[model samples]
Target: MEGSLCDLPAGLRGDYAAAGPDFTLPQDWAAYTPADHATWRTLYARQAALLPPHAATAYREGLARLDFTAGVPDFAEATARLRAATGWSLVAVPGLLPDDAFFAHLAARRFPVTRWIRRPEELDYIVEPDIFHDAFGHVPLLTQPDFARFLEAYGQLGDAAARIGALKPLARLYWHMVEFGLIREGGAIRAYGAGILSSSAETLHATTGAAARRLRFDLRRVLRSDYFIDHLQPTYFVIDDFSKLFGAMRDLPAQLAAARDAAPIPPGAAAPGDQPIP
Candidate 1:
């Protein structure tokens, strides 16, 4: 999920050939073996325990509304709660989809959750996103109104960026904000990005560790910034609130164009105008 759309892994376990034009497939809830459910339970318990102190308010509250602790949730059941909360629904996808296909789903208020769950041996880490990452990590936040709006706006913007061939910069924005973003909450920095919330190592590293520099979210700064996919991020952009995240979309097309022309800021490196958080 951290890589560029073009860089997504091809060998992920999913029925890609049987997928519809939209790249969605049945979740096949009943087909999951007991071991698969046990994996979800183990993953859920570990990550859920880490969330309370480090996770954003919206994420925690939204997570409480659902019951992922039981095991892999039935999409239909989870979708019902999500729909009631934010007018959004979940769709099962093979794995990661192409940029346009992904954008279209978000624009239409449909989230494409990967149908497969990671094997037990791969619990600590997985190269690609699975059901646990897609459902537990990302789904909860979709229940928040402002965050929901920001994502939808992001999807809408993706189409425009595609036409202008500026998806690389747009992807950086997604990497920084949607995947690894932080926020100032109650005088503390909290993790809201799915990529951080889902991983035990990143959850602690991003919230409490001293390794990464936390910088205030700036549209231009993020657009021109680079990120790491295989390791902990060296720099994270923090937003004050979701409203500001949604507001960034107002001039994103123009800003993305400008960023595409500018030289990229290397991962972990600071720029002249960056406002570093303590």
Candidate 2:
């Protein structure tokens, strides 16, 4: 939804209480109204139709493991599936978490989720993550073994990067890869990133559009590239294989240490010869 349950459509308001450490998650996860279920169903159906052709196999399988089609999933039930898959569980949270809290949760293998649904009118657009964005958009990909490991490593890297004051560059790498990365499989490009999978409109553009540049995955170059979070991504990095992402983490501690000692680059500036398509 555009905001929170307090801002929901008329039929969606129900007796829900807080469910997170922040005390902003709804307590009544089981009592979601019929409208809430309908909303979940509607969003699920649309994404399902769009995802199969573009999204990765792991995401498709994760959706099944979570029984995502059942409706707006109960956090407890969803956590059970995720825990079984990746030693990670979903915890309820209010909204955008502080960077430290977010990184800590990732480091601990716990994903903090915003436990509210978006309003019907705000289906395709919202300023923050609602249940659909959190659960539907992100939870499914966690089922993959490599992607799951990468998340934990990314969290650890984030903490270290924060200390070095390189969080912006690190976040940019994450933005391009984990959030919107595409991959090559059997000669065709496919979506593996959550941001593209849950987005019904952008999936097509991400895969076939000529407007955006598709670059080979290169760590330093990615950290130097600029992005616009409020709009469709101007460029995307394609991975020849997802395994390379996790492999980088095996030595990530050393790499982050090195990045910390390296000089910072200005935002929107690309590294030498790293020009992305206009």
**Among these predicted structures, which one has the highest lDDT?**
1
Pairs clashing in candidate 2? 1-118, 1-119, 17-27, 19-25
Please list the residue runs of candidate 1 whose C-alpha ends up more than 4 Å from where it truly belongs after superposition. Answer: 1-9
lDDT of 1: 0.89
Model 2: per-residue Cα lDDT at residue 200: 76
True lDDT of residue 167, candidate 1: 94
Give per-residue CA lDDT, model 2, range 150-226, as digits (tens).
88888877767876777777777677887788887777778877777767766887887777667777776676566
State the lDDT of candidate 1 residue by residue for 172-258, as single tens digits.
Answer: 988899889899997799999999999999999998889889999999999999888999999999999999999998889889888
Model 2, stretches more than 4 Å misplaced?
A: 1-27, 251-278
Residue 259 of model 2, lDDT score = 56
- Candidate 1 scores a C-alpha RMSD against the true structure in Å of 2.7
Model 2 score (lDDT): 0.73
